[model samples]
Each structure stands twice: as structure tokens, then as C-alpha cells.
Target: MKKLRMICLVSTFLLGLPMLHAQKKNTQVELEVQQPATGLDKSLKRKVAIARFSNETLYGKGIFYDRDHDPMAKQALDILSNKLASTGKFILLERSDLDKILDENDNSNSRFKGTGADYIIVGSITEFGRKNIGDANLISRTKTQIAEAAVSLRLIDVSTGQIIYSEEAKGEAELKSKSTLGVGASADFDISLSDKAISAAISKLVENVINNCMDRPWRAYFLTVDDGNLFVTGGKSQGLAIGQEFIVKEKGKVVKNPQTGLNMELPGKEAGRIKITFTGGDNPESEFSIVEFIQGEIDHSKLENYYIEEIKI
Candidate 1:
């Protein structure tokens, strides 16, 4: 009798454990769901441009396919552009936008080049194909529609004209349907599958894009300083906040490499430090900042000779 009683007690405890855990989980989920999303969070916004996204494969082309307006290429480009923008880490530009920015900058201030995309992503859809596979038995048949896509990408630094990152990725999508006695569902040629396949391929590379673009050190250039007021090329649109300190460094001389036939700039030494006082602009491409000297000073007359970097921890 005692053993049965003990068994009943153990079963009750075991059952009660799940109840306690469930109650705790419900409270935790409620707390998590109550948290709101704020769009004003401080996030890095680097300048990036989509140089080109070409479709090299013959998968979606026919006699009527226009080389200049390849739908496949356009689809891939749109997918990649949207994915990169969704991260909120880049100010995207097209080839046409570059000229407009340069012109506007030249008009606004000769010193500030405005915001040009330092990084450009070049991509190609290398391969794409779709097929239907069918399996049959005595009384039942099954069909599966499959799509496969492959893409190659290169992230280039516009200033250095160098490929900073390169990668290739592939994606696939499948849909299966089974019919018994010819009484099942059937699907037409779904173009959505191609979009999905391409999206999947680009999604795999977005992280690499963000990481390589950010790996390069952030640098702000001196635009102009007048009567103790200093202005830099970046503003709040590019993540500059008031009271943030940055170390200033003199511009290093550029030298041509004898072996590679390439011109490279030597590392600049620290000159001084400055703190941001104001950041204002109507748009990211026209942004500017006012700063006050905190430590050290640069040749204000030769603004092109100095640049700013984040203070080291």
C-alpha cells in the first residue's frame, strides 16, 4: 500500500513539473512580445552601389530576349537590392545616381565629394534550370517540380579598384504533388519559383557583403573650416551623433608600386582629435557635420590633408 502511495506521489510531481514550466514559458513569451520596434536605432549606413547584375545563363532567354533588358537579370538585381536595403546598413545607388551626386557635391562644396558609394557589388546569374520529375506505380503517380539557380558575386572597392570579396552561391526550390487515380492537384509553370531560387542564392551572400563593406575602417574627410567652425563630409544620415569624438590624421602620400604598377597611399599618422557638435542635412548625399577640436589640430587651410577616424578604445 505504501509503495502504491509513493508511486502516485511521484506521478503527481512529474505531471506538476510540466505545468510549472508551461506557466514560466507563457510569462516569458508575453514579455518578449511586448517589446516594440523602434526605427531610430543607431545603425551603420555605408554607401554601396549595384554596379551590375547580369544573367549569363541561357535558362530564361529565347529569340525575343532583349540583351539590354534581360528579365532574369532584372529579377536578380531587384532581389539583391531589396535584400541589401532591408538590412538598413547601406545607402544604395545606381550608376546614374553617381553622376548626380558628384555634380551636386561639386556645386555645394568643392572639398566635400558628397556621398559616393565606396563599395560596388557586381553579380551574375551563372546558372538556372527547372525540371519536372515523375514517379509512377501501379495505382498512384507522384510529380515534383524543381528549380535550381546559381549566382556569382564580387564586392569591389571603388576607390582602390580592387575586388574585396568574391563568392558563389546556389539555391533550389521544389514542389511535390501526388495523384491517386488522377484525382490530385496540378500546377502550371510558376515563375515565382525562379524568384524564390534567386532570392535564396542572394540571401546567402548578403552577410558577406555587409561584413566586407564594414571591414574597411570608417573615415571622414575635412570639408572646410571657417572662423573656428569645422565641417566634415558626414552627418546624422551616416550615423554621426553629437559629442562623438574622432581622431584626426594627416593624409599620407600616394606612391606607385614598382612591381604591381599600382598606386597606394601610405598609412597616415595621428594629428589630433575632434568632437561632433552638429549634424544636419536634407538627405544622406548632402549631409555635413560641425565639429570642435578636442585634442590636437590640423592645417585648416589645407583641409584635404586631414581625415577623421573613430577613437580607439
Candidate 2:
């Protein structure tokens, strides 16, 4: 009887090997490939920061879902940050120090001092959970699970305190399993559907972000002027390619708002146009490029007050 029991155990183990292998293969997660930046991508390059996402869904609040340990909001933020970095279209800033940086900037007397982020992205996870959609039978039981993820994102102009863009994206993944008699197959929740759903949502968000940035004009500042060459605040990272044209304008007058008593900038007259002659450094953080006079000449005396704006072709 012992020998017969051992034989049955060995048979069961052999029969389970194929099922295990198949399950492993099906659970293999596939990540999206990063793509190279195009001309449009370079033009829209800006300094950006991602704030920790808020959890607004009932699942995150532990209402319908029992799995309270899952950090759905944090996972969404991480995925979005990765997607934005891979695009090479934005200089990403650390979120942990964002509040401190903003505070310092606010209290500083210098206008240019402190960490500068042209835009800040804030998000909220609205839905994240799994639903069991399968049925059971007398001979065989079938189990189907569908994981869903959804996020709402807002792109805010840090300097203006305005929401430039807002979008929502959702993704879903399905997993199906079946069992006959005592032998069965099932996929883990993490690998089978949850991860895929998050990735899909991130992909959609990235597309919308890129499209919105493209609609805006590119702007930069003149860092220095020497020997008739203008050192601008942008380089290849900002899409300032060789022979690109930019309009240089002297800083305009500061006008005070009557209601708020806040200072605002008036539109400045066109100083001149400059063409990119040499691009220096590849680092996006300190990107700089040299420019030569293309149309009108810049007044060297007013170089400190000049700013540059790209002229779109």
C-alpha cells in the first residue's frame, strides 16, 4: 500500500509540471519599449515634477476591496514618472524635495534662485481593483478575473498657478483559468492582470501629455553675451537644433495689478533674431547653446535683460 501511494504521488507531480510551466509563461510581464525623441518632442521639452498621487477610489479607501495593503496610488505615480523620463522630452525633478524647493523660491528675494519647474503634474488614482467574473460547474470550475486601473492627471503651470491640461485614462486586463477534478491552474493577481492594467493607463497618459505640450510655444532665456555670440538657456535638449531661429526680446516693464497688487510683465518689443551656431553639453539640467546674429543685432548693454523665444518653422 505504501508503494502504491508513492506511485500516485509521483504521477500527480509529473502531471502538474506542464501546468506550472504554462502558468509561468502566461504570467510573464511585458513592458513597453522606450522610443527616441522626435523634433516635436524636443521642442516641448520643459522642466517638470510629479507630485504624489491622491487615492480617491473606494478601493483605496478600503470600502469594496479587502486588499488594503496594496499601494495603488503610489504605483501609478511611479509608472507615470518612468514614462515621462523615457520620453526625453522633459527634465524631471525630485518630488520629495518639491515642497521645500517651492517654499524657498517663494521666500527668496532673487527671481531666478531656487529649483525651477516649468510645469507640475498632479494625479489621482480613481479606480484600481480586481473583479471575479467566472462561474463554477459540477465537474469543472472556471475562474476569470479582470483587473482595472484608472487615473486622472492635471498639468499645472507652476509660475501661473493654472491648470494647463487635464485628462483621465483607464486600462483593463483579463485572466482566465480552468480546473477539472482536483487538478487546476490559476494565475497570481500581480502578474496576470494588475501590472498590465497600470502600464496601459500610463501609456495613455503619456500620449495626452505629449500632445498638449506640443501645442504650446517654446521659450528660453539668454544666459550671456560675448563677442556677438548669445549663450542661450536651451540646447539640444530643448530642441534647439543647428540653424534654428529665435527671437530675442528685451525684458519689458513690470506693471502692478490694481486688484491684487502683484507685478506682471508687459510684452516686450522684438530685439533681434539669432540662429543657433553651436550647441554645448548634452545634459538637460544645464543645457546651453551659442547663437549668432541672424537678423538684427542685440544691444550688448541690454544683454542682461534679454530673453529668447523660439520661432516655429
Candidate 3:
């Protein structure tokens, strides 16, 4: 009877091996947990910058640690960046080391101009704690170490310099070790667990941030017009398919805002509509699309004053 029970357990374990392997092999693990079926349009991606991340929590401030601005803050920032990048929904700007990137861009033929961002994210590690809990009996002992973290995020519109979205999330990670007569498993301090906790916390906010940032219009700039052929700064890679039609709008008037001391652009007016006739380019930055004016008229000599926009649904 005992042998039969052992064989049954072994069979159960073998049956689950394929599922475990599949889970481990899943490439979409970096995406959000239980992601919804509906998602953003493939061609529409936003320009995002991680402006700042700070540690507001007292945790991880040891004698050797920089308590004024803890490394935990930077760690959280990196984790958040990875989560956002995984979604492939934004053109992430290197804000943490902008100067270095610019210098490198100057030295090389880099296409990145270090230009404006549609949105910027400011985040902070607000709370963190770690502790070990133990349970012991006559024949066995079990210990678990848990790391919990809370993160706050604020999405700022670079165009208006306003806080567009704000949210907070919490996450926890744990490691458990069990011993039967001190002959089983044991563990020491695991620093990587903290990172996992922070990552989990950041994951909770990524989808929301993406949705809020995408609530605005998408635009493609005019590269040039030559010999009656119009070229736009977007191509197939950006989800700009041939036969797609978009409105061309002349840029709005730039006016100084007395309240915020910022220069804001007024609403642009539709100048014409264009349909994508051809798309070429290897990547987003260098991509170009040839389009024909379907309706209305566009000024070829003053290309800077106009931009191509996706038609509103």
C-alpha cells in the first residue's frame, strides 16, 4: 500500500513537469500579470522619460549606505524601466545619464537628438521592510524571510508640465526554507528578493501609466517634400501601414502661460489629410513614409509648421 502511494505521488509530479517547463519558457513573463486581451494599437507608441526616482523610506540606509538618497531608489528605478521597456509601448529616453548619451551621440552618427518626451515619470520607494519568521516543533523547523515594498508614481505631461496620473502600489516577496531534523533546506539573506518585491510593485503601475499616457493624440513630423513627393517621419515599424490615412495639422500658436511660466501651444487646425502610399526605413528613428495628399492642401515650403496625426476614432 505504501509503495502504491509513493508511485501515485511520483506520477503526479511527473505530470506537472510539462506545465512547469512551459511556465519557465514563457517569453511574455515580463509583461503585466494577467494582461487584458485589449491593448494599445501596434503603431502607436509614446516617448517616455523616467525623470527621477527617490527613496523616501528609511529602509536600506545602513552606515555605508547613502541615506540622503538611497541606492534602493536607483534599484527601483531600474526595475520600473525594465517593466516599461518590456511592454514595447514607449520610446524610453535615457534621462538618468542624459549628458553622457548626448556626448556619445555627438561622437557617433547617432539618430537620437535627445529631444522632448511626451510624458515623464517620477517615482519613489515609499516604504520597505524585511523580516524573518520562524516556526519550530520537535521534529521540524521552517523559516521564511519576506520583503515588502511600496512605490509611488506620478506621470507628468512634458507638453503641459502637469501631473496627469498618480498611483501607488505595494508588493511582497518571500523565501521559505524547511528542515526535517536539520537535514533539509536552509537559506541566508537574499538581497535579490528586495529587487523582486520592487519589481512586482512597479509592475502594478505600468499598465495604468501606459493607458494614461496614450490618451492623447499621436503625431508624425514632416521630414521633407521633394519633387511633389511628401515624406513623413513614421514608417511600417511604427505601425504606419500603407493606405492608412492621417490628418495634417499646422502647429498651433506658441503662447506664454502666465500661471506656469511655460510656453504652451494652442490647438492646431487641420490643414489636409494624407494617405500612406509607401513605407521604408529599418527602425523607428530613421523610418520614413511616403504619403499623398488625399484631401485639403499642405504647404511644402513650410513643412515645420505642420505635422501628420492619426485620425481620431
For this target, which candidate reaches the highest TM-score against the unseen true structure?
1
Error of 3 at 64 (Å): 5.9
Predictions in order: lDDT: 0.79, 0.71, 0.78
Model 2, 1-313: lDDT tens digits are: 9999999999999999999998776666321122222233334577778755667877645455533244776677778888988887777877576545434545222432334566778787777888887777788888888888887888866544556799889988888888888578975555547668877877888888876665666667667767767687767766667666777887788766688655556777898887777888857767888878867877676666777775666
Count of backbone clashes, every candidate in sequence: 0, 0, 2
Ranking 2 against 3 by lDDT, winner: 3
| lDDT score for candidate 3 against the true structure | 0.78
Candidate 3 TM-score to native: 0.68
lDDT of 3 by residue, 33-151 (tens): 44422322445777777877888877756678774356788788888888888887777767656324433534221223344466778788888999999999999999999999999
Task: Look at candidate 2 and tell me the lDDT of residue 36.
Answer: 26
Q: Is 1 or 2 the stronger prediction by lDDT?
A: 1
Estimate the TM-score of every prediction. Answer: 0.77, 0.66, 0.68
